[model samples]
Target: MTSRHLLWSALGAAAILILIGGGWLWSLPPAPSVTPPLPIAQAERDATIAALKPPKRQRPLIAIIGINDATETTDYLMPYGILKRADVADVVTLATKPGPVTLFPVLKVEPQATTAEFDAQHPDGADYVIVPAMSRDDDPAALQWIRNQAARGAIVVGVCAGAKVVGDAGLLHGKRATTHWYSVKEIRGKHPTLRYVEDRRFVVDDRVATTTGISASMPISLTLIEAIAGRDKARAVGRDIGLPDWDARHESDEFTFTRPFALTAIGNTAAFWARERLGIELKDGVDEVSLALAADAWSRTYRSRAVTFAATADARQSRGGLRIHPEQVASDWPAERLLPSVADRRPADVLDETLHAITARYGARTTDFVAMQMEYPRNRAAQ
Candidate 1:
């Protein structure tokens, strides 16, 4: 073909292709139209979002630590419930690495995120880091993390004997603290430098908050919730949980917290710490906010039971919410009554007694761990 002919042919083919393509485009069903996201003024939107969400609830992050004396899962969970239910903080579990962390004899909780997984660039940075007491005697990695948390300007609070770990990190050097009365000896044995009001349930020193022990977890959590949220919210949640904090009447040395025994003298400090740290408030009760009222309709019914008041032997019946006979408590168990006030003994005395008894009975659990850690470096003095 001649060059001009070839050019004409190519032009005609191109025209045909264009026409065909155009026809195909026109023939197809109109693509479902997607409304474009409105041109959001980045700065304005950011400002609006900031204002809509109360700044306190957006505390970036809060960590529930794991390590020795952490058997207090309820301590961690109750505060977690307040934080999440109230939505005052981004709660995450921070472990040495990132896996299931065994808590005491019963539970194994996996960390929500690891220390390394924590992104510094996250839009919300952590503002509060809570170190929970572990059941294990010690965990060096978790201790180091606590030191790191303190360095990051995060508010630090220790629940139950977890305070000992914090104190061991030297965070509570001059700070006042309290732990289980049963641990008063070991705590003193482990941290003499830490000031303690053996009777106090919880204590806050500047940026550091410490609890007496497991018993004090709830009260501390409530305190934290109120500090960050508000009294109305805190009270609402207290009522919902049947916290018995109504008149501060929950005070006193001898109120049975739950099924199992605890680490603190009275109030559950972990709960109090969460209450103070994250201001979550949901007022629910046996009435409108019953436990039966699940996110769905298939849940079971519930009750807002009050703490049972213990009555001494024939000490005249007093009118109260729920009365629990002393016999129903330790009074009925002859063995418990005769079990001796061994708790009244000192740590050193107890340790010596334990060692002697163990040596006479089944010997130490294992000698290897003792050899490796015992001589490594203990503060010798509890402080």
Candidate 2:
């Protein structure tokens, strides 16, 4: 063949090869981006089964103490949920008296057993006693009960201001401890002997473990679970609960003790009043408006919750015809007093006016209102 003919023949062969290779590649299935689940190790499977199996003798019993209008909701519920979910302990909510225990942030919970009942059932006392922060500091009876539990060698875990209760009970007389940043000074003042450590999410001194704030309950609970079970078991439980990388050593100083405004917005537009009437109107932008008001009210670090004056605990409609649910109601406002109000959406002047009005109402000082928005049920309340 001539030189041009030979070159054309070679190009044709190369083209055919490229087409054949491309066709073969296109016929193959796409590669997976994610890794497939690995089979549980035999030892891990056995350990899990053992951990989950109902104890023939007695499972590690955890008593979560609740007091009337005292217990912080998240502090109590988070540990209870985590321990129970981990299957490391038989967690029970205990109270000074039998009945509904009112938790902060307008939550009402009934304890599974009273102190007397629990004492009667387990004469040796609880393996672990979890205490949440209370509204009042001077509960002689509760303090005494806590002392008794500690004396009986129960691992006493205090969440947030529960450290005060622990201190008041003489548990932290000389032991190192910590609490919510806002109360650190107060705690140190009251219990001068306590070694108040900061920046730690949870601190363990001897048998007692004190956590920083409401959210710290999670990591601390995982720590407890790890101690009761094993690291693998704890990791498995954490994975099951969507907290696969939880570590107790982690510290949360994000919502430090520095005073932050506790703003609660109240009221609902006609559209927010009747949810069934209008489905959900995004154009009205009620949620966005409320978020804007919240954002503008205080520093992003401040705590706030949306509330309405509607009679029932049902969803409300916003002025923009959006169905919205308020975190609280007027009759059952979490705080003793209400802050000033701000419009949902308006000009800068209006926003500034609203902010000014709120600050003036709240005395210009951004007080720490941690209790107002701390505790909430892990699961949804039954309608």
Candidate 3:
């Protein structure tokens, strides 16, 4: 063919390809309707709660494990903060190896112990091992440590995509579980023997427990509180945290990559040059749960990423005693870039407020994308 004819043919093929791709994107299912989550049966709740009860001890030992390189902010911190607030367990933050763990979408933290240190201190193993979503699911140190703890009779609780860590450790084989809505398809394909339940924020099968997504951390933490102490104690703690109820109820199907969500993500991500670094000024006694939610939500909005800044480079202790390392000095970012103060706000309220802020800044569709990523039921409350 002549060069002109070849050029024309290539242009026609490109146009056809664009049309086909657009058609498929349009045909993908939209977000599911918002509905009240189906209630978990009382009998099931009782059984599940009972299943997590620790062996007799003065205070049950709980270990929250993460990789030193990177871990999901909310997944690692929320549970630690909540459990410490409850004062029902001896909670220790652990890293796969020594050094501070860099939390994604937000801050960093100095783990109370490394897996090696934990083994030395508590040779008998902890009553519960809390696995947060790490940067990689196949870290050898993490998998082996979890297996050791599980074999030693610890109830393993996997938060969000931490379910994959549990699954990768060969713990969820033939067990019932659930994980982050976005991870379900891939996780299911990887661990085909496990039953992936739906419409549930958390699931428990034998000694292995798994939760839905980042936001599910709050509810799962409360659930663990109940398992360790009692219903009354869990109720009080839940109220203190601004979540009066911590049931395993969730509308999982509602969170998906819809057309609007895709458009917002694509547009926001494509405008990389326009992206901003949003600052969250840190201080001693900051509420870890709220900080996590605020930082996490804002960072997910494609338009910006959250950076924890403080007066000094030293780590500041959160209200519950988790030490958060600041990413930058306060003077590095201008006043307009700092997020509004979230002092005294509960985690759930912080999330709602952040979502509203995201809507105001990037539009409602971007806010929806952030919420969907969290697997949080945002539309119901908004409606």
How well is each residue in 1-383 modelled by candidate 3, as lDDT tens digits? Answer: 22222111233244345445778657656766657676678999999898889854658999999887778889998999889999999999999888898887668899999999999999999999999887778889999999999999899999999999999999999999999877899899999999999888899999999999888888888888888888999889888878886688787668775667666666776687989999888889999989999998898877898898988888999998888888987655687787987788877778888999999988988888888777787744321
lDDT of each: 0.42, 0.54, 0.83
Task: After superposing candidate 1 on the true structure, give the runs of residues whose Cα lies further than 4 Å from its correct spot.
Answer: 1-60, 67-71, 119-125, 244-383
CA shift of 101, model 2, Å: 0.8
Which candidate number would show the highest TM-score if scored against the true structure?
3
Q: How far is candidate 2 from the true structure (C-alpha RMSD, Å)?
A: 24.1
CA RMSD of all predictions: 30.0, 24.1, 7.3
Which segments of candidate 3 are over 4 A away from where they belong?
Answer: 1-22, 33-37, 56-58, 379-383
| Clash statistics: count for each candidate | 49, 8, 0
Model 3: clashing residue pairs? none
Query: Best to worst by TM-score, what's the order?
Result: 3, 2, 1
- Candidate 1, residues 19-102, lDDT tens digits: the string is 455654334323222232233355633332232232234454677776422334444544565555455556766566655554
Which of 2 and 3 is ahead in lDDT? 3
Residue-level lDDT tens digits of model 2 in 216-255? 6766777677767777887786665445664333223334
